[model samples]
Target: MPAVLAHAFAPHSHDSATKTDAALESSRHGLRALVISFAALMATAALQAVIVARSGSVALLGDTLHNLADALTALPLGVAFWLGRRAATRRFTYGYGRAEDLAGIVIVALIAASAALAGYQAVKRLIDPAEVRLLGLVAAAGVVGFAGNELVARYRIRVGRRIGSAALVADGLHARTDGLTSLAVVLSAAGAALGLPLADPIIGLLITIAICLVLKDAARQICHRLMDAVDPALVETAERILAGVPGVENVGAVRLRWIGHALRAEVEIAVRHDATLLQAHAVAVAAEHRLIHELPHLRAATVHADPDGPPGADHHAILSAHR
Candidate 1:
């Protein structure tokens, strides 16, 4: 690292301590909301499952399973959020923010597993039909669960955005799945009452398939996060801004990555090496300053200097002839 660039890291790395404190404070409120949401989901899950068992409604049972899974998933999300806010130690210099991503991976896996199991049972039931009873009760319970989940989802979403917590977003997604499955359960219950008992198991299987597809998508997102995949848009924007810097020749390579909550970029540029050391340093500092001002996400930038020989000198050929 150039001497000028060496000090470049100081500005943002210092603020990391402040961000850690802010994260800790924000997570406390988020955790409280999460706990309440978990309790509500668990109660709804048990009530829906009992109603399904009594009514012999396969659709309702599957919907209840979704709620139960959502409830279980919240605990880990809460834990991950709390852990993410903790201060970085020697073992974890980046803190634990990645915990949310890990929790999301686990949640998607669990939901997919449950969906596969439900689908298998639904397929077996389709092979040999069974009489369903009290279809109205099953439908009513499903509606109740849907309403409850929607309420919880709304609050969770608010907290998530307020605190910038990805785990909170995952929890909201879980609640949304419950509400959607409940609607399907309501439809399947109605169909069963109208002498289309096969629709109950069929709808159950479809809901399961839908959840599995969602989990597959979630898995892809988690993989991208873990890989630290650079967002193309951000990289393109940085390239544009870096290229526009005064006194800069062809901008060579640009790399953007996360240093903490804030995004950081390492930029390379070719400049006249013959320029006074102070002049090159000033130009580099200007470039770095402009990038951060233009894009708040950019945490740091570095410029590499190259000697600017006299024009038309064929500097490369002169070295070649000497060899």
Candidate 2:
């Protein structure tokens, strides 16, 4: 008998109620991170806006716009986290976890739009050069922007990685880039102080370029998540764990994927051909238990136990025609 253990009914493991509570806790952590970071960024942007108005620094203006956009990005991610708490339905059997991926898409779009707007503003300023006033205030504002963004970046990245959220990690990287570009605003202020009027717009253009680079990276990460790509190291770890399980002759195909921040696995293992149905079922349940306990963020796994038939015996030959 082929013993197949499904995720929902995997015995001797975390129950469905426990899984639901864990998921809700994870979502709450994500939402808390977003809210705090959003507040920090908004305050930073508001301060930079005041400085931009007084100093007329195009570089500072570009940096402020990026900060504002970064703050606004929290909205979609917060929505994604909230939606992820919903139970899986028949129509959407996988649940609302993919909403995080969609939020990542929206984040990428927002980044692209910010880059375009910043580039356009810089080019316009270059064509019509103007004096950047209050150089001291502009430099001070740049420093403040860097401090705020760096703090938020560290917090977001820490929580994101802990929760296995690709979107949150990407957003943290975005914030880090914004921090580096904020320093460029200080350089523009220095250039203006040295009597070079064109430095402000030139630095603005450079900031735009930096934003584009960040956009490329964030887009790549989000696209990879959307494509169901996981780390090769994780696959290796799973294989190793399954191979170490008792009563398994060999480990065969092992597939893994991310549904939201959680991981799901499908595994095939071989058992003794003479094993009774109860024995095969025990092995399958054991395999599932080992996987859920060992893997990080692994919500569930399905283990299919196959009989270790004699060497020339084909167990799946009947399905060969379909393939």
* Candidate 2 lDDT (Cα, 0 to 1): 0.90
Q: Could you tell me the TM-score of candidate 2?
A: 0.95
- The regions of model 1 sitting more than 4 angstroms off are 1-17, 238-252, 258-323
Each model's Cα RMSD: 5.1, 2.5
Residues 164-194, model 1: lDDT tens digits: 5545765687688679888998899888878
Candidate 2, residue 247: lDDT: 86
Which candidate achieves the best lDDT against the true structure? 2
Residue 127 in model 2: shift from native, Å? 0.8
lDDT of 1 at 322: 72
Task: Give one digit per residue, the lDDT tens place, for model 2 in 114-188.
Answer: 899999989999999999999999999999999999999999999998988878888998899999999999999
